[model samples]
Every structure is written in structure tokens, then in C-alpha cells.
Target: MRTTLWALPVVLSIGLGTGSLAQQRSVTTVGSVMQLMDAMTIPASNAVFNVGRQPPETDEEWSALALSAVVLAESGNLLLIRDRARDEAAWTEASQAMVEAGAAALGAVEARDVDALLDAGDVVFGSCEACHATYLKRE
Candidate 1:
């Protein structure tokens, strides 16, 4: 059975519009973007990661996992918003990696494939680590 991801279109529209609108508007701060990651992306990634230990058993569980993946993917778009981007090259690369990883997780979740979800979780973890290594400030 094919699963429907309700938020995918919304996320796609936002990502598609970012290039043109990003330069025209400055809506959020990098800190705010990070907060979005902490609140949404990280948890979503955890759900993907946890799939190895406890795979979703029901349709509701699967749908919830799909939502998590959507959140993780959309968070990448949020990071790409010009106002929140840290730099031109590396930041863009890392953000795109995040988007791809999230998308992969979503696909795996839709397929109900445990192994692919785990692989996507690895990509998600790598993207997070790379970005943090490059940009995260320490006191």
C-alpha cells in the first residue's frame, strides 16, 4: 500500500520558493533556525534512528514517523532561507545534505523498510555533525 505524506507538498513548495523569496525577505534568525532543528529536526531524526530498535507496528505509528521525516526535511529548507544561512558554500552543502537525508528517511518510512531508515539515520547524523563542527560556537 502507498502511504500519503500530507506535508510533503507544503515542504516542497517552501523549498522551491526559497531561491526567489530568500533575497527579498529576511524573516528569521539563525538562532531561530537552530531552535527549529532542536524542536523538530532532532526529534524526527531520533524517530528514524529508533526504528532500528522499535520499528513502527501500526499505520498510526508509520504516519507519525512520516510526519517526523517531513519535519526533518522542512527544517533543511528553513536553514536555507538566506537570512539564516551561515555562509554561501559549506552551509548550503550541509543544508542540502540534511534535505536529502530527510527525504531518504521519508522514502524508507513510506516503504516500511527498516534498513533504509537506518541508513538514512546515519546520513542525518553525519549532516548534523558536519554542520555543527563547522558552525557551532562553543564557550
Candidate 2:
């Protein structure tokens, strides 16, 4: 598949990022992260439809957002754990950027950050793409 589509995550224009989740943990945790990646599109789809419009302002929407963030974060954390040669800090920054990309996308639309909204579209995509590149390939 087109893994490159989500290769960037949320660049947030920062000095790259990574995650804090440690590797060599229980397999279940890693599996959970995989599951989260698998579920990533669920909330993102909802958010896409809701963005620039009346999002699911109810608890459901909030929950969806939170869920999305966790999945995104987990993948980033996984990346951090997987890539020994990969710079930890950069991965973490990238992971946060990925999270921020989604958040920024929503926030941009909420605050009408038209440019950010436009930029986030790709940023968020990169986040998903990047994670899939490493993890999905593993599976």
C-alpha cells in the first residue's frame, strides 16, 4: 500500500519527535498499539466528516478524539521502540507532531486556521502513513 502517504505525521515544524513508551514490554501492549493503528481510521473518518462543521460536540466526539490521539501516539511510541538507530527525540517529536497534526487539524478548523487546516490534511496523513510503513509492514 501507499505507506508514504502517512510518512510525515504532524511535523508541527518542530525539531522532530519520538515517544516515551518503552520497548521490551509485554507483547500485549505492543499488540494494543497495533490494534490502535488498525482503528486509527475510525475516528479520523468521523473527524473528517465533522471537521469545518459541527463536530460531534457530545461525549462521543470527545471520546473519538481521545481515542485517535492514543492510537496515533502509540504508533509513534512503537516507532520509537522499534528503531534502535532511529533518533528517539526525533521520533517523539514526530509522534507528538502526529498527535498535534490531528489536534491542529481540528483546532484549525475550529479556529478557522484555514492554512493549518490545509496543512494538517497532509500532516495528519503523514502521521498515519509513517506508522503504517513500519508497523503494518511488520504484520
Which candidate comes out best when scored by TM-score? 1
Q: Per-residue lDDT tens digits of candidate 1, residues 1-139?
A: 1334777776668868785645666564546866887898888888888888999999999999999999998889888886688888888899999999999999999999989999999999999988988888898
Best by lDDT: 1
Mark the regions of model 2 whose C-alpha exceeds 4 Å error after superposition: 1-31, 49-94, 113-115
Candidate 2, poorest ten consecutive residues by summed lDDT: 12-21
TM for every model, in the order presented, reads 0.79, 0.44
Error of 2 at 117 (Å): 1.9
Residue 81 alpha-carbon offset, candidate 1, angstroms? 0.5
Query: Local distance difference test, per candidate?
Result: 0.86, 0.53
**What are the per-residue Cα lDDT tens digits for candidate 2 across 68-115?**
544544444454445321454544566666766666665655554455
Model 2, position 40: C-alpha lDDT score: 60
